[model samples]
Target: MIKHIVKDTFILQRLSSVATENDSDIVKDLIDTLEANKEICAGMAANMIGINKRIIAFQDNGKITVMLNPEIIRMSDAYKTKEGCLSLEGQRETTRYRSIKVKYQDTNMKVKIKTYKDFTAQVIQHEIDHCNGILI
Candidate 1:
């Protein structure tokens, strides 16, 4: 079982990418962490829990979705808003797309392409920023 989170800015500042090996364990950890934090947050990234991998789990409309190696393929219209992170204190101004097309892999390593708009897109962009070592 995983307890506590990495709160050091230096560690969270480092960038992350796709896991090259032993993804099953990483996926399990991600799922476990996300499930454990479901009531506290709407989304989380691997790095938020100190794992430097390109993975993010988010809850939308009572459903949890996990994405590995997610990338925004297309974006339309930018909006400035304030968002908070579980790994950091308080919220800040963030510029995010109103809508985005993302490509990512599922836990089974299946490729998926999907588009998100409004709040869902905001959540995804925030988590992707974590994968890229951005804190907002």
Candidate 2:
């Protein structure tokens, strides 16, 4: 389980490495835990930014989405409407993005790349910025 740190105690450092052998198990466990938890919806919020993001794979078309502390290292010229975050009091601010390509490590410690477009990409970008200590 992740230790959800308080705002004052939150730190913005790179995440630690998970054991290679235990990655799948750990990610699965986390996915189950989060999915079972009624709060995963809100836990899906920026509150997870500083919190250790648990890796969870989406079952559709074998999409493995391990989003723990994922960051967007690059962005395109596209732009989208700002999304609201629970931690931010649900105020939309119009964050900018055209397209975004993100680099992240998955449960298997394998590097992964995902391309985002329009609003979806913006959400990812916003969440990534949150992981890097930018809030808005």
Candidate 3:
């Protein structure tokens, strides 16, 4: 089911907890919500849907990818940019990386490490920040 976008900064600002296999339903809801808002949004954190879990779904290449407990292990080539959120009123300026290395769990709770660059990396960084209770 597509969930409502959370706009409450108080909620979005709270740190997200680690996700477990039981949170699989949240992964589905995240994907469904992201797809529903694909025209205007690229990604979303679990907090964005009123669930403060470490899960994120984003448009990568031509498909949507889900990550649970995503952490940026390494980041490089930082630059400033503005971003818009489906739960925010307008775009905000913030720093982003051109490349990033992340550690996260898949829906099945298997750990995976991956490198991302350019826009994709930026998107991941933004969502991870949401998990950390950082808002731009």
- The best candidate by TM-score is 3
lDDT of 3 by residue, 62-101 (tens): 8999999999999999899999888889889999999999
- How would you order the candidates by lDDT, starting with the best? 3, 1, 2
TM-score per candidate: 0.93, 0.57, 0.98
lDDT of candidate 1 over 10-119, digit per residue (tens):
99999997864467676677778878888878888889888899988898788889899999999999999998888889989979999999999888888999999999
RMSD of each: 1.4, 5.1, 0.6
In model 1, the runs with Cα more than 4 Å from the true position are none
Cα-based lDDT at residue 61, candidate 2 = 30
lDDT, candidate 1, at 102: 97
In model 3, which range of ten residues has the least summed lDDT?
82-91
lDDT of 2: 0.50
- 50 Cα displacement, candidate 3 (Å): 0.6
Shift in Å, residue 128, candidate 2: 1.1
Model 3 residue 16 lDDT score: 95
Over 14-124, each residue of candidate 2 has an lDDT whose tens digit, in order, gives 333323535555565545533544342322322342334433233223233456546577876865465655344566766587788777666556678887666556656
In order, candidate lDDTs are 0.86, 0.50, 0.93
Q: Count the backbone clashes (under 3 Å) in each candidate.
A: 0, 4, 0
Please tell me which predicted candidate would have the highest lDDT against the true structure. 3
Clashes (candidate 3): 0
